[model samples]
Target: MKVRIGVGHVPVGAHDPAAGLAELADELEAHRVDSVWLSDLASAPHTVDPLIGLAYIAGRTRRLKLGTGVLILPGRDPAVVAMQLAGLAALAPGRVLPTFGIRPAQPADRPAYAVPPGRHAEVFEEALTVVRALLSRPNVTHHGEFFHLDEVSIAPLPAKPLDLWLSGRLPAALDRVGRLADGWLGSNITSGEAEACRVRIERAAADAGREIEPDHYGTYLTVVLDDADERAVGALLDGIRRRRPDGADPRTLVCRGWAAAREEMRRFVDAGLTKFVVRPAAPVTSRRDFLDQFVAELGPMET
Candidate 1:
């Protein structure tokens, strides 16, 4: 398997992350890493807006693929997000990859501007169609259950069609990805489970008469340097446990050290999922320090 590795994170400390993202992008590019991804969490004051943050990094680097591990699609206007992505596509050319996901249901994590509780799926499905039409057509008119558009269109289309990837592991969500998405970007699932999901997605793709690249299947794996601060591990798990409640051993979910992380990567590759984005599983005093060491350690392992 030809594995590709990338790194992403929720910016925890940097007050202004534009310079920081740019610097990190530069480092990733220097190490010949496949991409640099950003996690989108608009409500988190500590996190930067993924789209805006990526634009800054795009301007600074020429090679690293700037991606959203998963951009929330339920809360915002699809036309607006499509326009922003379309503009970035022009500026950055063929190096943009977007992965779509739903917003958090928890009250505190929900964006100040977001779809109502329990109605996100409805809005997201409609808006995703709107985005697809707008990105592919010079004139798009959509009148769906949750959105309305009349002969509207976005300018400066991407040099190539934008392939929207989806992130999820539930049966319904996996089927949706196979039917509507170009690829998958799952997380927190075991290799055996990932293989099962891949089978389901393949069946869905075949039924839909669409074929995706073998390499587009990917996942986000939480990783922390073995020697990272103990207090940091506790803080990180607190945040992660809130999102992952399946009772899988946290150690199984996280790569505790460089050797362990690489071994886990190989297993995922054997499972037919090679594209990966590793995010720190613990808090750290220096984002740069963590990334600097990570990229260097991971460089020798990439195929």
Candidate 2:
């Protein structure tokens, strides 16, 4: 099996978007990571807009693909997102991948987004269809259940139509990915869960008489340097516990001690994952430090 490695950013409690992203982008390019992924969170502090951040990084880097780990689709109009992604792709050319996701319900006070309950699969499928049509056609009009487009055309068409990805955990979402998306993007899921999801997606595509190649499967994992002091490890574990008290054992989830982490990577490789987006644990003061350690550990495993 082949495996690719990438890097992800978590804008948790960030205080300075410009400084943080500048540092992170430099580290990612320096490490030669395949992609740099940003998350979309309504509550994140010091969070730079994902597309703007990617554009900034694009000007600074030469090769790293700029991507969104999951851009919640329901929160924004599909046409608006299509235009933004298409513009970004035109500016970056072969360096942008827009990964769209269906968000769960939000409070009434929150922005008005229309993803009906239990209908994320249907909504996402329809939304993708509309977005793709608008991007690929000069004068596109559509009247869908959730969205309506009237003779719209985005100018300076992307060097190529943006590669779309879907993010979700349910079987319905997996099936939708098989039918509509260029790839599947997710996080905090174990290899076992991912493998099962992959099976569903492949089967769904086969049933549709679509011989689509397996959509790219990508997951974000927290990385911790092994040679670091016990205090460092403790801080990392504590952060994980704070974020997910009910999730897997924090220690097990953290890829600590380079040798042990490499072993874990091997397991994921065996499970057919194409890419690993490594994000450092909390209290990670030095982005380069963690990335350097990851490169040292991952170098031997590279195909």
Which number leads on lDDT? 1
In the range 184-294, model 2's lDDT, one tens digit per residue, is 776656677778877788788788776445427766677664444567568666755654546666777767666766777777666666667777654454677677777
lDDT of each: 0.79, 0.72
lDDT at residue 149 of model 1 (Cα atoms): 90
Question: What are the per-residue Cα lDDT tens digits for candidate 1 across 125-163?
Answer: 787888888898899888777788998978987767899
For each candidate, give its TM-score against the true structure: 0.91, 0.85
Segments of candidate 1 deviating more than 4 angstroms: 10-19, 105-107, 111-113, 285-292
Q: Residue 3 of model 1: what lDDT?
A: 73
Per-residue lDDT of 157 in model 1: 77
